[model samples]
Target: MYGWADSTAIEVLCHTEQCVVCGDLADGFHYGVRSCRGCNAFFRRAVTFGMQFSCRRGGRCPVDKNARCACRACRLAKCFAVGMDKKAVQPKREGTNGNGIQSQDNSFDQNDSELENRRTSPYFDSVQLTSPESTYSINHSIYAQLTDYTPLRSPSPPPECPFLLRLCYEFSEVKRRRKCMLCKSLEEILTEDCSIRDPATAEDFTVVFQTQMILMFEWVEKLPEFKMIHDPLDKTKLLRAFALRYMLLDNVYHTYELGYNDRLVFVNNNYIIPGQPSSNFNSCEVVNEMEICALMFGAPMQTLVSELVSIIHGRNITIGEIMTVRRLMLWNPGSIGLSSNAQAIASQASNNAMKELQQYLEQEGIEQSEQRLEFLLLYIPALTKHTKTMYEIVRLIPSFGKMSEWNSFMDDVLRGV
Candidate 1:
């Protein structure tokens, strides 16, 4: 429903002198794809300004060198469609050259330098949407005033940052809407009031896994930070890390919340029982748990569900904190295997999210805020221990045996993570 009929297709590189996003003059590679300075500037300004453009003519605008300005939304969409990475558009540095890149890849060097000088100065962390008829300029005093913090905060804190507020809500909504995704399915009647008495069937696990994976992508793609990561491999790697943690954390928390003992609940309300034979966890057929997991563990894999649920239930974790953990787990900029641009963008995004969490806590005036922060952030690594076990179990599933053989979007995710 957007600009070109095939919005997801990555346009092939045309002649060296042609731009991939629009058939304009080429200006080398920008964000891993070849493009022109004109398109580069437009993309940069759009991202840097956080511009949200809409297509009035149903979004199927023709964006070419001759009419790049015809539809801002389509042009921007085409940029991403042709691989113009938003992560490549670095955060607007208050002062030039303060931002750091985590990876040694120099592909970002030129773009970073150029973007540094062109970005809006962070006169104040908050930006206002001015009337389209008027111009907005940086107010140095506002920046100084905003930074002047005291040990004591105002009795009434300001409004929650819009992005953070929206993020918190979106995270919360996922839990509520996860059910009914596949309306009228066999597991549709499963609910919180009951425990999954039988071991989960192979097909039960696969259907839930597929649904989770789909939801994961949906959630990840909406993130502004993840949007910036233009490299497909880097995106996959970051998602891979988030996926295991997401699957494990989301289910464990849901299980604990519903007071379900030692049984993990799926998004669609199907629950996986504890102490089932590993053979019962099959993805190859509708059979109950496959034996491949047992061969790896040399045991029933009882610890998988029981131990996971224990961590959440014992802690009495809250949904607010789980929401934070979900976003924070996207990518650790320091994690190995990320490209330079990906690492830099991830670092900024994760750091911003961390800061936003603190701000949110303070704004809400939550009790023992510092401790609340510590418990969840630290729990990230502790929760990671189960991922190794998870990867071992899921990777052994016959359907997932060869990643390249699968046609689903999860192919890259399963391999990269």
Candidate 2:
């Protein structure tokens, strides 16, 4: 266990470094590293265990200002203050390609270097991408812009950090012009196509998807499982968009699509802020809306949504979902009841659950919708949880094989099931 340095009255002042939390440069050691320790721990817990933190009161865990200690998520974010690389903590495989992630070696360094060179170029310098006169704010403006250009495919890992260039903060003295141009142009071109047709439903979907993505991204960043997955530098925008789309599709198939349009209208009517355009929506905000609905219905509805989709659509529905289905689908009968660790227990549980599902299908002749929905509701949570966990493991050490990693983590709990 890591020791907490809160009460030590110890302020170790250091040169400003990049803050892991907001990706801002800090002038002092506010957290564990050059950043604020609060963000460090928040990053650790959030990234390490994939903890879902809720503000006991509600909404926006304040960072760097008020409510600093209130939210676990925010506090850990403070740790990233000085600088906490979730990727740093992730286990490394021997002799991996660029970006230190396990994936097709596509020369991420070359791409990133080229981008960096362009940013430092004299031509781009003359144009001035990040000056006060420039109209774009990389973080706020560019990120919002790219949402319109959500990727349709899972892009291979790129050599550079996608999020870094994809969304940058408004800095007083902007240095890189080429990078700015690329970022701005990419956002402009990509986002041109990403408009929400039905503002209400689309907004809701956007919110839920954002929350999950943040959770997954931050979680994967620190965990060893991140290393096992593709490079974070890949076409991150595209992958993230795909992830978001999958969640939306799952939502539609599970319940949102099943319900009447009136319910959607009512939900959106009550949920959305009156003035804000539905197109300029935030994922967290939408998640809040969906969460409210979940509370109103008193149902663990998210799980059901994924499960229903997975059952109906046989193959792994989303990249995230695929991770889960693959884990569950790979269980061999011979591996059951053979051990007593957490892995064994989980495997056994999955094996048993699958067996029960098979049995349920065989024994109870229920309507397809009812049966599928019921199974989906139960299975989605399990699958998602496992998928999230597996991703965590992979992020830590990309070398971990599918079954080998699963078996090791769960121990024997899943053994001999």
Candidate 3:
């Protein structure tokens, strides 16, 4: 258990890395406190002009990214409450314009030179602040630009978010890029053609499995947190912990998204329909004289499907929901074997992703959204259990048949454990 000081230190470290005014990613030390560029600008404007503000809500309003501009009084009050020093506002710095005339930069980033000097110190570790002439301010413009090229599917999510969008685009890109033997795109499956595919033969399963592994590698490479982990061993360990879980969830959800709630789906055009309780198989559908696929998939996989899918299906989940949840799965900070730095990245990224998930729920107007969020997070444990089940299923693959050429990848995946 943590003592008060320890807990307080932990809390401060977390908050220090985030903007105290509004919980967007911190740009750097702003007015003597860590804050995002937008909040830094807002505070400078408020303090420089000696602007006063009034609250219509008894001076108690939530000031987050979505509502930072909503309540200026509470926002300014919260700024001081969080130790944003008004005294740090230096007189506006002027630079020579194109006309050779000195003009003040309108961007109101107080103490720019000081922040610049501190940026190289061990204390500050965030993206660089915007240059005075760079016009990109609308709360999350920098963050939003990360996902600006990612085309939205439908019913766009809210909270001016990026994690949600980037994750979805990654999933879509991974799924869409893989085509059939005929070179047909799978994008149509999400809308019009999610027909239940027959169980794959051993060769088909091998090909699909190999394809998914490659896709997962590609997708993981694109993630910001994954890129931050510098150690090869840590990267491999994180991927090992996440690989089967990601493939399973992606396969299942992809299948579900194609309008099949009662069955578990896989890409490369195959799926697994749950069997009736106390059932028998021909021992010929997938493996060589072995009741593989659904048989080995068994009770645990069924529970994973029914429990996870029912909630998602019943609740009418959005693209944001599964992708945010996948982000949590991918960068689980508590996942064993990560180095301190890798784990720190995981922890911060996971927290931000969870916060975005909550923000998504609130914007959806879900009744009791916080409680619903708890319900969503509960699946994280279930996902772990399902991943373990997948390991067991993967172990069974070797005994089923003889395709040493096609089976080497699976063998390599299981190695060095």
lDDT for 181 (candidate 3)? 16
Tens-digit lDDT string for candidate 2 (1-417):
111112111111122222333333334443223443334433433443344333332223334323344444333322322234445543212465577766643333345335333423222111212432233222223233333333212233455632221112211011111111112123223323322235443323323332333223332333232233342222122132234233333333333323322221221122222233344334434444434333322233334333433344543222222233322433322322223343344455455544544444444443353455355446644544433322322232223222123222112111211
Better-scoring candidate (TM-score), 2 or 3: 3
After superposition on all C-alphas, the RMSD of every candidate to the true structure, in Å, is 17.0, 21.9, 18.5
Clashing pairs counted in every model: 11, 75, 0
The count of backbone overlaps in candidate 3 is 0
Collision count of model 2: 75
The candidate scoring highest on TM-score is: 3
- The sequence of per-residue lDDT tens digits that candidate 3 reaches over residues 163-248 is 66656645554453343211211122222354655654444445556556555665676677777776665666666667677777
Question: What value does the lDDT take at residue 51 in candidate 2?
Answer: 40
Error of 1 at 201 (Å): 2.4
Per-model TM values vs. the true structure: 0.53, 0.23, 0.53
lDDT of each: 0.55, 0.31, 0.57
